[model samples]
Target: MLLPQVLPALVVGVAASLMFLGISFLSEEFQVVLWDDLPDALGIGRYSSLWMITMLTATGIAVGLVVWKAPGHSGPDPASEGLGGAPLAPGLVPSLLLASALGLAGGVSLGPENPIIAANIALAYWLGRKAQPSLPGAAWVALASAATIGALFGTPVAAALVLSEALSSQPGRGSLWDRIFAPLVAAGAGALTTQLLAEPSFDIGLPPLSDPGWGDLLAALVIAPAAAVFGLAACYLFPYVHTAFRRLRHPMLMLPLGGLVLGLLGALGGHLTLFKGLEETKELAASVGGWSSGELAKLAVVKLLALLVAASCGFRGGRIFPAVFIGAAFGLLAQALVPEVHPAVAVSSAVLGVLLATTRQGWISLFIGAALAASPSMLALLCVASLPAWLIVTGRPQLELDHEGKALH
Candidate 1:
């Protein structure tokens, strides 16, 4: 009986996943050409400090041009938008898609999540209204957002947890599960679609923690709050950085300027600090022992700053991906500082803290942290550690801004 009502959501979810994967494919192809083929043809090292600076700067200019001349100014300032902001006009989708693809391929410190979600929402809303005028717009928004979240994380559970939080806060008529039934079906279909097509995985292969001990608990208590402070610093600074860029008064000036700063940051932080930080975090984890405490700290600081700048200065992307990198770096730094602390515990706890501050979504943060650690024992530690971290960020300004340019709580 329920299947009849949910059939449309399932179809929409599959379509949304295909759209997300399609954009990702285009971004990867462009990334290879820009960083691999073009550099090879020019006989320049792709990771060379100078070349990274050049490419990032050029990417900024290109994205800026799109924003300045393209429709809808690339779908609003990224700093003012959250992951599931309102849908855009369908006509604005192409420019947003182009900007997002360029930012991803150009090594900006933002993720494909935000722009991709916005694009999907707009498309779904427009098409769904045309097909069924009686279905409320919110239904399309809910299904599209759920599908994208599931596809992004390669799991239906992520969408379920996130939507549970969202739906719990709203005044709805049905039981919570009843309300989310269609979205859950959508999320499941999206997750399966991406799983079959992309096979994305968040586990970075860190050694598992078979034993839980007092020392690990102490490490979580200390490291999680410390990492949360780092994330809070960015949250506090977000509005100011955004204001500074707004002073430039045009995308042509601010975005190119932002790109130049990002290029310099890339040079200082080295190649690891470049891009959205998913693959880079894996590389960091693979050679965790090779880095000194200072090097790990530097990577975290640099990536955090890059994320701040990219999101603030009109770049079309999300902050969550770079926040994950910062968390991993700080976690590794904690282990570097105290040899007794288990790496899995330290990493997950730190990830929990940073994500709590940056994303303000506890379930998603906990899920990402636990996924990376891949240790059953670390779950209790992360849940406990998240309490203090959550308290720190609960009443404070979020990383995003409201309409008047003030920070959102």
Candidate 2:
């Protein structure tokens, strides 16, 4: 009985770890190749409206080629794919990775990091099955899945926490080795890749934080429930949006529709809301001192709307990047209201919004929030704010999709 339980976990975890290692190398290689070769080879220049349009057009064409040629690769919006919480098809890994890379690199306003992580896990399971056809199955696949997730997000703790919560959410379940082993191996591999590639660290600049006063804490208390409301709404709306788009059923039409909607939103919100959040978020954090609380609030609303539309359409990626973007906007707004606290503290606090909207596990949310903040003071605030966020989210409706692409009843 013990052997049956443990063996699957070990095999899945190790396989996931190896796959994580390989994906990290590939991710770096893809980035370098695009930077060095794409610019010179394709003559794409400094990103501008014209350049972005060109890039978007190219991405659509590329997506068209792939979707037409490789049918198995096409799936639901990957940002919400995790909401499915089911094992992925092994053959889908390569195409998923390629599509994500193309989407991210070609300026289609998608992030590949999460998809890469998921793909690595799928690849791990495929390899393991080939090597050990007799390996017993358990929740080890979930563990391995967590390991790959940890590698991408730069925090194994968060990845592990998510896996544990996912398992516990199912009740009457126990720990799976796959969850622990793969993430450990993948995180190790990812760290090695990060060091060797000298990848730029994610730096969100916020001023030093002061201790949270009663008022700040109270505001956080209110914000937690508000954030949970948004998270639940997102979980509810995403599937409908996806279903509506699928009814159109044409990749060519679907992608351009995404581009048009995104571009229109960008025009309304300014181009800052258009692409991935990295550059714009850093810029926003730096300028938090200049904006009024109300203006910052508007940015948050717009970002939330934009991200919802982006995910609902046929976009091929994750919401975490845009969630950070939306959270940072809220932080800046809150800073405008609470000038007494550090801007970093405000950013850190607003991040609860992202966590609440995304997961039931408070620690996982806090970990991601603190990772984005990258400061000891911010981490402390994250722990405090996460409490109420967790409580509010504890009973929110879940977004569960089954293996057959149907919502679980």
Model number with the top TM-score? 1
Q: List runs of model 2 lying over 4 Å from the truth.
A: 1-54, 76-80, 137-140, 169-186, 192-196, 199-202, 230-233, 292-295, 377-380, 394-409
The digit string of per-residue lDDT tens for model 2 on 260-339 reads 66555554566566555766788888776887777677777766766666555555666667777777887677667767
TM-score of each: 0.98, 0.78
Model 2 accuracy (lDDT, Cα): 0.59
Clash count, candidate 2: 7
- Predicted structure 1, TM vs. truth: 0.98
User: 217 in model 2: Cα distance from truth in Å?
Assistant: 2.1
